[model samples]
Target: MPKTNWKRNLYILMVCQFFVMAAMTMIIPFLPLYLQELGVTDPQSVSRWAGIIFGANFLTAFLFSPLWGKLADRHGRKLMLLRSGFGMAIVITLTGFATGPWSLLFLRLLNGSISGFIPAAITLISMTTPKERTGYALGMLQAGAVAGGICGPLFGGVLADLIGFRMVFYVTGLTILITAVAVLFFVKEDQQKKEEIVKTNTIEDFKKIVSTSPILSLFIVFFIVQCALIGINPLLSLYVQDLTTSQNVAFFAGLAMSVMGFANMSASPFLGKLSDKRGTQFVLLISLLFAAIITLPQAFVETYWQLLIFRFLLGLCLGGLLPSINSLIRHLAPEGMESRTFGYSNSFMYLGTMLGPIAGGWLTSVAGIRSLFIASSILLLINVLIVKYNVVPAMSKRNTSTSSKKKSVANL
Candidate 1:
């Protein structure tokens, strides 16, 4: 295979990530309303169907992610990206034509089965970029996704109000399709390296990857952090309604959600650069510590504005976590296994995504929405302890051993 320019590819992937993320999230702010429009009249039935349909995608995505990752390892990452990006574009567009809840649910399940574009993009960038620059590249890619996530809801709400939800789906589908086209023309993969497959069995491949201490610990941290990050999502709007007297509850709730994305978008690249200089382990520790501190206040907020502020601050801390984790994974993964390693990691992430909202909703029913925030904060704090004791020590010893070996080689 010919040499490829990774920096150029990174820029292209970032643009694609932005569009793909935006397309995925565009329906979130209005999904329930869409269900109501589709003939689900009873409030209880609407809620139940909404939960099932909304979660169907993640549940299937969690199941299928590792398979896709293994395929990317054997084939190439860009092909997986093309498969997911175009598949999602078509599935989401088909969703616009769903006449009832079941049709929508089925489409969502299909969407999840074909999904993993972002993870594919991450794995591609990790493989292409130099180790020293991995943090920055992944960080910039994250910023793109977060920026899209911030804009997606606002755009969706406006488009839903102006052009209608069905039209919004069409527009989102077009946007994603355009991204797929760009990847087809602009992104190039080194096919020569990916042709060889070391592990044919997916289950054994997953086990082999996770059996290592560093990799296993990173997966645990990723799962817990994602759970904490998304745990409050199901109850965030209700919590806003409780804290505010304003009639525009939806707008405030949306703002509260977007503000965190905004902060995360702004902080990701900076934190990525910091990780490059200071070490990913150091950056991960600080992010988790600050994220826990910031998250605690949201549990006690008396007003919506207070909650938004704390959430934004929490986003700043979140900005560092995923990039640090990805960078570490890139550093630790064995040669030619990067995609499969990330595939398992993405599976853990999807599992957390699938569980967090369900767990949050249950927690809200049992205690209150406030309890969700408290639980998330506690989970993050516990993750900090786990990382400090297990992850940091192992990473430090590895770095020391590597440095000593390099010094001995130089003397010889």
Candidate 2:
């Protein structure tokens, strides 16, 4: 790789992430309505089927992400990117033609199986970019993703009104197809094949990840954070309704959801740079601590504005968490196993996405919506202690061991 080519690759990949993420989420706001169009007339059945369709992607992604990662390691990250990008582009475009809910459900599952472009992009950049620049690059990459997430719904909503939901899927498919083509034409990935390791597979990769304490800790942190954050999503609108008397409840709910994403996008690049300077462990600990502290206030908010403020601050802290985790993983990964490690991390993320809402929905029914926020805060705090006691000390020992080895090498 050229000295400056990594920068170009990062920029292209960031743009690609934004469009792909936007397209992936474009259907979300209108999904229930779309389901109704598919002949699901009963209210209860629509609700049940909507949950199933929404979760199907995450479920399949959780199972397949590691497989893609292992293949990425063996073949090349670019191949996996092309594979997922083109695969999803076609599958999602065809989603516009689903004759019924079951067919749409099948497409969603297929999309999840082919969903690894973002993770592949992460692995590619981690391999190509300088270590000093990794945090900033990954942070910017995260920004692209969040920015897409924030914009996608609004875009989808307006487009749905104008062109209809089916057309929106068509446009989304086009967007992905164009982005995938851009990646093929412009992105520079000089993926050198690693020396073959005998008896390598996704199962063995899982075992290796479990045995690696630091990597395992990062994965746990990601899972816990995702579960805590996403678990609130199902209840957010109801919580907003309890706090506000506005007629346009949907607007306020959308505000609550997008504000966190906006703050997250703004904070990610800055936090990434800070992690590069302050050390990732320190940034991770402080971010987790503040995130926990900030989360508690939401459970007690009396007004909608207060909730937004708390959510913004929480997003700032969350902006630090994932990039730092990725940075740590990039450094700790074995010589030829970067994609496999990141792939497993992606699995945990999807797992959280699938499980978080279930847990949150159950908790809300049993203990009320406010209790979910409190529980989220408690979960975050537990993560804080785990980071402080387990992850940070593990890093210290690794650093000490490396230094001692270097000293011995010098003495020789």
Candidate 3:
């Protein structure tokens, strides 16, 4: 095989990730409002529909992501990216033309079913990059997505205010379409022949991968971390409302939400580089520990500003997590099965994403909103132990034995 231009690929994919994330988020700020415009006048109904529409995509994405991963392995990662990117563009554009809540909900479901561009991109980058550079490259890729997510809501709000909600969807669709074109033109993949590729049963393949302790631990950690991160989201605004004296509760809540994103965006690249220099497990463990610690304080904040500050700190800790986890997965994955592994990992992630809000809402109803933070903290603490005992010790033992063999070879 000829040498791959991984640097070029990474840069291009970063841009694609940014736009894709931006497109996804651009609809968020206006989703409920758009539903209202489409004839859902009852406030309670609007709220119910908003939750349903929002979650519809993730639910389907959770079910379908592994299938996409299997296909990516069989054909190519680039093809999957193109499929998702174009698929999203068309669905989002169709969403702009939706006349009722059902149509919009259906479109969101379709969108979720097709979702995998970012995961595919990650798999491609993981496959192409040199092992030593994986953490930094994945971190950079994560930063692009984070940056887009940070900017998207703000831009969506401004655009919604200026041009109205429907127009925002049109603009978002166009932006995604542009990203797909960029990928089509700029990104390249190393194609493998059918005869060279080994076929495997998807169910059996998933079982084989997760049976490994370190990788299984990482998958569980992915679920727990996502649950911890997003579990607080549904109630965050309500929590802010309780903590604040200001009349503009919406603005303050939005600010609180955005500050975390800003912090994550700023810290991701630096932490990624740090993981590269130090080690993925080192970064993952420290970040998980600190994230758990920071999360505990948010449950007790008396003022909105205090909660905001803690959320920011939590984001800083979170910056190290996904990139390090991804780097570690790449390190641990068997050759030629990288995409399938990532696909399964993403399924766990989407499952967490779907479950997080439900768990948060349930916890709030049963135990109150503050308990959500505490529960998240406990989950993350469990993850810290998982990494410490299962991931770290296993990695160290493997490294030590590998080193001993190297020394033996040198002496011989």
Candidate 4:
């Protein structure tokens, strides 16, 4: 918990977070294929079950994120991380051994129930880092996660094809176990013990956050932003197929996805530093505006390359979105309530993650693939206005009040 160890902890958490995201994402691309191997051989059933299998974790995760977060606040963030990391390592490994879809779904639910590694890491880093440097630290952490997400699908698909779908699960589990071990041995968590936190009603705590300036609004902003971003993913492969006559649509689809992650990872650290210097609100507002503008053109793209370019630009804008949202959450979190605040934010986020695809599918069935992009643009634009009215003025008012206190002390 010494000052110097914060830096060490941040670095270690970044690496562990990368492995955690990669390991989890590694199994995503093979769910439906794995279903066939498990005897759900009918194409229609596979598609239905694939969507169910993909969403099962998030549904459980949405329900449990807040509970784990509350525990993080009362116990220790490190304890939560170990509980999740080790628990997931076991659950995920067992997932590989599942003989049927029912077992797979049950194990995924278990995985989601125990998961809190990223949030725990975020809370720990936020508590440890200097306020002024928090944006930079969280940004770097996000970059590591984005990098893992980008690599995970590619490696998972290849490994599934080469070794088998089952073995990939074991690899994912082993990687997560190693990540847990790294955190156990190296990461340092500085937090109040259980007795130190005032025993307050969880509902009262939630009400307090809602009444506070910008915290609740920021939570909504993050959920909407995440929704707008993820809404495109379910349709992306189909969009790529429509644009290309070549059979290498998969390659182009991968490129489109990878390039966006590349742009996001490349821009995150720089944007985080910029937000620290200028302001997170300012950076976030502009990012939302540009993200909306960039998304609009995706609907009009005539070729894969044009869509690729827009997606990359959209990624650059999004790079500024998530980390800044997270940094602001850390700044605005009340004393002894930081982890709980993040917990609620994570709940809203998991909700968005679950709903985004469903919304996209529904919209696409009604209108078209092109309409989903436009709708995503509209959501971002709506968030831009929310931040403008709901988030921005509150932050300005707080800053003015802080400056007034400083001036009064100077006069004294």
**lDDT agreement with native, every candidate:** 0.89, 0.90, 0.88, 0.88
- Separately for all candidates shown, the number of backbone clashes (residues 3 or more apart, or on different chains) is 0, 0, 0, 0
| Cα-based RMSD of candidate 1 | 1.5
Model 3 whole-model lDDT (C-alpha atoms): 0.88
Q: Write the per-residue lDDT of candidate 2 for residues 217-256, one digit (tens) a residue.
A: 8899999998999999877999999999999888899998
Candidate order by TM-score, highest to lowest?
4, 2, 1, 3
> Which 10 consecutive residues of model 4 have the lowest summed lDDT?
190-199
Deviation in angstroms for 246 in model 1? 0.3
Deviating ranges (above 4 Å) for candidate 2: 407-412
Q: How many clashing residue pairs, candidate 4?
A: 0
Worst 10 residues of 1 by lDDT: 191-200
Query: For candidate 3, lDDT tens digit of each residue in 1-412?
Result: 2345888999999988988898789888888899999999999999999999988999999989888988887888889989998898898888999999999999999999998889889999988888888888998899889888878888998999999999898998899899999999888887776656666777888887877658999999999998988978878889988998889887888888778888887888889889888888999999999999999988898988789889899889888999999998888886767788998999999999999998898889999999998999999999999999999998888778889999999999
Score candidate 3 by TM-score against the native: 0.96
lDDT (Cα) of model 1: 0.89
lDDT of 4 by residue, 1-412 (tens): 5889888988898888889998988988888889999999999999888888778888888888878877877787888889989999999999989999999989888888888788888888888899898889988898988899999998899999999999999999999999999988998776544565566776887897767789988999988977887877967999999999989877788889989999999999999999999998899999999999999999999998899899999989988998889899998988777888998989899889889998888889899899989999999999999999988899889879989999999999
TM-score of each: 0.97, 0.97, 0.96, 0.97
Candidate 4 TM-score to native? 0.97
